[model samples]
Target: MKKIITKELVPGMVLADAVLTPKSNILFEKGTILTQKDIAKLTFYSIDEVLVHDNEIGEIMTISSLPDGQITASERIKQTKEFQIFKADFEKCAEKFKNEISDLVAGNKEFDYKRLLAPIYELLQKGQTNSAVFEMLNNLRNYDDATYTHCINVALASNILAQWLRWSKEEIETATLSGLFHDIGKLAIPEDIITKPGKLTSSEYSIVKTHPQKGFDVLKNVTISIHVKNAALMHHERCDGTGYPGGLKAPQIDRYAKLVSITDVYDAMTSARYYRAPLCPFIAISMFEEDLQKYDTEMMLCFLENIVNTYMLNTVLLNTGEVGEIVFINRNYLSRPTIKIKNDYIDLSKCPGVYIQEIL
Candidate 1:
């Protein structure tokens, strides 16, 4: 079986795995052939791509990285190293505008074009890594100020989510920058409010709510595109009209803003915060699944499906202390799946005697 990106999906590919949504699960039954219409339907579900099994996995050409289900943590670590190097090179681009606040203020001038181009070149030069960059960012949280790191982490998560939705390369880049600076206005807020380490007062919360507008004001003079500014301003807006700044609903919100909103919530819930300990990925995914109506259903499905498939190759130890590689996922119960030991298969879904304790 080979994984293909949605852009590369074509007719006549047989699904090697099942496709799922927040409300339903559709297993294509291993050998089922996919027609163009079937492919189109899957695309409507925000499926970036599907794994098709043939004599062997065939390559599907795509400008963006294809989602491969068979990626390992070690491989993710390698990708993280590559990103670190890219970040180091990219930071240099910010040097030219060091003394120019206007250049920095202008969203366009702040980004290092060379650095922006490096990662894509590297991704092409090397092969696409199976996992998204967010997984790596999640592991890098030992820095002093957690808020800034959290913002960066949220941005990475948002960009990965947007990429999974098969947005154009230009849109993906703009979304990424927007995610990175969505909270720039927070820079102007009082530090005490930003890091209160306790419940915020209604007055303080009001101040916090002004971040979107403040961020837009800060970048108003910058050369950054309107999409980026909107992302910063509208990320906090929710579909239920419960979000801050502007209570925009469904069609009123920008696509990028919606994407950032989901990513922001996921990162915040899964990270250690002043109010609570971090939630595990499985739990976080479940929570997101429960609230799918609050987001673009298709995008939410894509995010959940990608995350489940991405971690399948990692080594995990069951509650029974049995260690093995995740070789198969049960469509009905994603949290539990079949594991492959030395020479046998342990279907956690069917094996009532055993269970997964934790992922190592």
Candidate 2:
């Protein structure tokens, strides 16, 4: 059930719980199918919000197209009370985590790992599946949000991937924390370069690369899990030994760090920026498919397959200016799903130049 404002209520939404007057008299009973008059009565009494069955919310919002033929799953998820709560909680986590990082950098605070995990766990309590969570995160990825939002995104995505990989409960928690703290070194970098809107000069880029080691320096002194420390240091390391700081190969890199690396790149690449909108997940997955050698092969393939399938039945915008629904994921090319446009179907791999531009 989702608790949405009375203003957003529409006829045909079934109440999951009873609506009551201020003095607690029943105005409507549970399981009542709402009508336009019911909605007006709700607003007349100034009932702020009410719980509606999940399936009744916009008739499972993602499955129904709008009047103009737009079916944005992210937008649908945005209308849920779950998304509103998640967004507020996520912002709180980011702000708190950012302050904690500053405190860590100043050597004035003890790490509170459990406290940090609390919000993410509460978000999990909202009962959104992995794919639904992704849609919510995608919706929340606005340019004006705090930069610390990326850390939480990585943490959430890494947690989901860890769960998919069947990691132990302990390992999943560690992975989540590792993701949350992976980029702590960025705190030491100048805000100008971190927020720079243009391409970084070689010198600026070189300075930015120092964050890994800088992150390691702060973490090494803390009494945290070794996996988390390694995640901070080696998340950028590649399987092919081309990544920086240590240039460590797969075997030399920490396993947890390897897991975080995949999510790190996913969120970083898909996240909105000042110069460009966020890339579609399909585009990011395609990028990963093209560079599988750069990450842990097993994890990368697992992620690629897992993420690609999550978009099954999703409405998508093609680069050719047409919109379609993802009906199949090509096993050979995980990024190239078969799309259905009205009565026609196009296999993206067969149509070489076609690609998904956005999820709508």
Candidate 3:
């Protein structure tokens, strides 16, 4: 084993002993393989040195052990009767939501706010928490890039976040509605531009950017809550003032808009786009961490912390290919939690090159 300076350590070196935070908390356990992300965690915690073995795992092995069911965790979840029922409910509700959004945008009449929320209510009836909803959605997917699917996904996530915040039922309704129509303006954008598989031109992008205003314009005259209208207009507005339609900062942004902003980006990232596959939740977590400055930090931290907490006791696949069950979460690194593989527990925060590749 070698005691390597934290700054100089490279990926693939396995830990020789458990690394710890300055408070002496176990950070990374012995046998954890190094990853670039783990190294960054080291820097974040001000750790100077770690003990690692000299030899590498050699070509990086991925260990998948599902011999019992002969299927993946997600696949197993899908085979359940509950999931089938949920799938039917989800499809029926999404179609209903699509029609509701169309009617709302077309000014056909004052639509029932309760009707707009039926999709989320339907999905919520299946699971007790947002975590369970995420589990079902993450594994079951055929409409990754659908606008209606995106809206429903956002509403569901927003409701979860609001509940996590302990918001009132009325407040939750506003949040759910905010998410449901956050992109109603997109309906105004031609289907050709909205569904374009190729890179969008500058003009096309500008047209797309008008969505928030268009959404706000429709909601403005309607009898919806002001917060919902603001969310429609400002969901893309960043805390650091980098967003579009209006270059507003944290204080200038509406509270509900802030919540919707985070969920909007999260669902979008985890949903598949035409150009790329859906990102793993951990990947989305890491990206959130990287852009922490742009979001409402307090809410973002709460969002990340709770999202990671939902994975407790879940089996996960590590970047190094090891299969393990999540055992603990370090508040400092929501994307890198402790895992139990075989007979041992590995706190991923101490292992620089390792991370959750998939929530199996």
CA lDDT of each candidate?
A: 0.64, 0.80, 0.81
Q: Clashing residue pairs in candidate 1, if any?
A: 6-48, 106-222, 106-223, 107-224, 108-224, 318-357, 319-357
User: Residue 308 CA error for candidate 2 (Å)?
Assistant: 1.7
Per-model clash counts, in order, read 7, 1, 9
Against the true structure, candidate 2 reaches a TM-score of: 0.78
TM-score of each: 0.62, 0.78, 0.80
lDDT of 2 by residue, 1-360 (tens): 899877677767999999998879999999987754466557545577899998664322122333586546776778889889888887787878887778888875477778778887777666478877777787888886344788888989889889889999998899998988898888888989988865577899899899988888888878789999999999989989978888999899999889999999888767765544566788778767867888988888888888888788988877666778999988889889999999999999999767786777
- Best by the TM-score measure: 3
* Model 3 local distance difference test score: 0.81
Candidate 3 residue-wise lDDT, 145-171, digit = tens: 678888887888899899888899999
* Worst 10-residue lDDT window, candidate 1: 57-66
Q: Per-residue lDDT for 244 in model 1?
A: 78
Q: Per-residue lDDT of 1-360 in model 1, one digit per residue for the tens?
A: 788775466545767887765467763456656643345445435466677775542333222221367554545665666666644533342332232323444444454533443443343233244364555444543324345555555656666777788988888777777776677778678889998865567899799999999888887766677877888889888887767788888789888888888888777766665433354465566556556677877777787778778778767666455668889877656666789988999887687545553344
Candidate 2 off by > 4 Å: 1-71, 145-147
